[model samples]
Target: MLRFALFVLFGSVFAGCASIQPYYTPNPDIAANEVEDYEGPLDAELVAGTNIAQRIARREAADYAFIGSAAFTGAADEDWTSAMVRLGRTLKTEKIDYFTWYAGTDTATGMTSVPVMRTSFGTVWGPDGPRTVPVTMLDTDWLPYSYTVPRYEYRVLYYKKRKEPLPMGIRYEWPGEELGRRIGTRKALEITLVVPGRTGWKNDLFDGDVILAVNGRTPTKELMRQFCRAPAGGKLKIWRDGQIVEKTISADPSEGK
Candidate 1:
């Protein structure tokens, strides 16, 4: 009986010791060699709660936050509707979640690298073009003090329109290569392949392998956004087992699955 009592006491003490031990999770802020959209796991306590606008505000300035632009596609003409449509799709995919005007030079000869933001909204291709406004005039419901502020500053809105087809095609890359410039190239784009269960092909996609391309296109920030449009059930061209293998992969938003 005394031996039984002593064992019980020891077990209780051991359980208490285990209960008090600290828990550890990987730090999301650590600069990973590979590029990722979010700083940490989407499931992380802080990240899961953050909204799209908040993410943009954290990365860029108040002015830059509101406005988003992708380089204009197709030939420029009196008709700018095509550009607007393309801009809308890009904005939707980015979850910019709001709308605004498109900005560019009159000729449209030189365009910005990713996209260009305009101070105000105006007609796409009317005789006078879209009306323009100041960035300071813009307002955001997400902003904490937008109501109480003395003078509000402006932000740029993304505008994609329907335009005629261009002779040359263009593409964009994301999580942007800009990240590669910050962290070393060795850590670039090496993430565990998250896909739906139990197919012979998916099992072959072991973690730590690098993605060489998507349908023979270089993985760019813009290209990734396009890829997200058809995210699930797409063919992934990856380098594995000392060779390149094309595998079909699917991941839904619900599971991050």
Candidate 2:
């Protein structure tokens, strides 16, 4: 009876140890060097007119047109219409078109339970004296694992038509490239277009101009947002032809550009 009790106690201890141990395995689906790269064309092409000139004319006639694209990070099951409405409200515009959406790879890590095999070697009493026996048991325990996952990015081209004039008559890169005149000395955000004769304010700013600052402050994301929301115009410090020049911007409240 005492020997049987010892065996039961030994089994209980082995079970407890097995339950506490952990096992881990690599997730095979995600590779170490895997990255999300978007090679497709941006949703900037006009959806209305047939030729470039006609497209520009149609866009100018519209109250607002999506000139460029912006991206927003969201969940896999995120509702797109609601997101668009929210974005429009934030930008103070109701018109949006030329929409594009996609998902990108992200990484997630967590601990989870996994099954493992536990083996034990011990001695047991038998009719032929002490006998060695090998025992194997299937068990489950918690382990840490990491892998790449898919996250959604919502992108769209939006336009706004309002009587209020636009603060600036230029189209800038939303994720703009940083340009410098003297390497580390003179830096500015690259501007893509300055519509000729479309600006509300009177200034000598032109297309391909690099903006260094706005109203004497360094241009930042928040500053850009302020510019977008501003009904009136502001000052712009531009880098043109190896010189920094200040231009006073005005707003045009007309329906057409």
Candidate 3:
């Protein structure tokens, strides 16, 4: 009688173990608002490409409207509102006229539809000890789980004027190492200096301006070379003083060397 009671007790515990369900925990940084659900399959490459394309398109359009667009990453300690305010102040300093912000959920919830089997207690045989066996049930299946993921947001800015050219006397450098770390790409070329009294255009740009993109695309070494060689003009989206300032560029005639 005692042996039978022990078997029943062990079986109950095993059943309980098999019935456990998976759970998810939300990240603190995620906002209360739940963003749109992704309808497609959970493919990392596809999702990343789509998001990147969307961001790039927005930046380009804004650059055409404002002469440039700047990008900012939210700090670990800052909330969304604080980040927006900080960016806004910088844009105001750069004399940016129109701007728009976009946000996306940093985490996605994943659930599984398939059921799975788990180890559970089985009946005891007279000759053998209590047996363990595989149990399959609806409740025993591993349920869906959720996790936090990092994503990118774009803050596109517009100038009061359109297609404004870069100030005449400025020279840009591809500050590969420093800017590469900030922008997450070594390909970033930033405008590091404005030569005093070199050109006729007003000196509106400041030092440490990062060239985010050219003609709505991230500048590559080959593209920069082409921009330098292009005769008529080229469009550029520059990050200046924490804001994106758009500018049109024409080959500098004075710097023939």
Candidate 4:
């Protein structure tokens, strides 16, 4: 009974405090002397811990640039997938392209109070010729119930995924990711990432939109790269909402030259 009451009292308070804040700190050295444009989360990739170690041992760090890292605390019951997706949407705004994470448990303390009620028998002198009456009263107990919470300290390292391994920004659907999402189920480059609040997003070009043609030419892997790297004053035909729509190209970052 005590434990149940305690939990009921503290459940809301605990849930309110459950939010995880990933405090991101970037390596200043890399921040100052790196590429200016950072594509959105669609271009970022998550790395396995073992793969990170192998890449370092092989001196292949040049393939990707180490950007920075973030440290956060999470409860033992927290979901890693939810955390990563939330982080991807927010952290990539800082231009983080690649990331890896690990965690360890630590003991943390929590405190709350449960209100207790007591029942007693009181005699009424004048009511119904002194009948026994049951009286309920607040215990006025301020005693707090305290317990320990298991906390996980998490660390995430961020990197800029160079395009050498997997092409950034866009991916083609030819036995590839998004193959099932190809426009008309035909081969096309699926737009997965676009800088938020930019001309592209402003003009209705967004992730999941498909590039059916560029400047009256069929899209190839190379052509897709050209269009994204330095697009300027051209007709970009895209497939969206089961309709062929054309977006005006401008010299925006990562949009083209």
Listed per model in order, the count of residue pairs whose N, CA or C atoms clash below 3 Å is 32, 1, 5, 6
lDDT of 2 at 227: 66
lDDT of 1 by residue, 145-228 (tens): 212212211122231111211101111112236544443332224433222332222335554455567656766544543454
Cα lDDT tens digits, model 4, 122-203, are 9888845887889998775555455555665555555554444222333333324555454455556666444444445556
lDDT of each: 0.34, 0.49, 0.43, 0.51
Best by TM-score: 4
Give the deviation of candidate 2 from the true structure as CA RMSD: 20.1
> Where in model 1 is the C-alpha error above 4 Å?
1-188, 192-204, 228-232, 250-257
The estimated TM-scores of all candidates read 0.24, 0.34, 0.28, 0.35
Q: Candidate 2, TM-score vs. the true structure? A: 0.34
- Which of candidates 2 and 3 reaches a greater lDDT? 2
Each prediction's RMSD to truth: 28.7, 20.1, 21.7, 17.0
- Predicted model with the maximum lDDT: 4
Off by over 4 Å in 2: 1-165, 174-187, 225-234, 250-257
Give per-residue CA lDDT, model 2, range 1-257, as digits (tens): 01111011234444433322112122232222321222222223324322333333344343243333445565465444344444444444343443233467778899999999999999999888998899999999999999877675444454444243333555454323344524233445555545555552245666567777878887765576476456676888877766777877765545232
> Residue 105 deviation, candidate 4, in Å?
5.2
What are the per-residue Cα lDDT tens digits for candidate 3 across 1-257?
A: 01111111234444433322212122221122212222222111111222432432333233212223444443222333233323333333222222223354465689766655555656655667667666545444547788765544434332221233233444455677766676666666765445454331333556677777878888875575556555565787877555667887655565441
lDDT of 3: 0.43
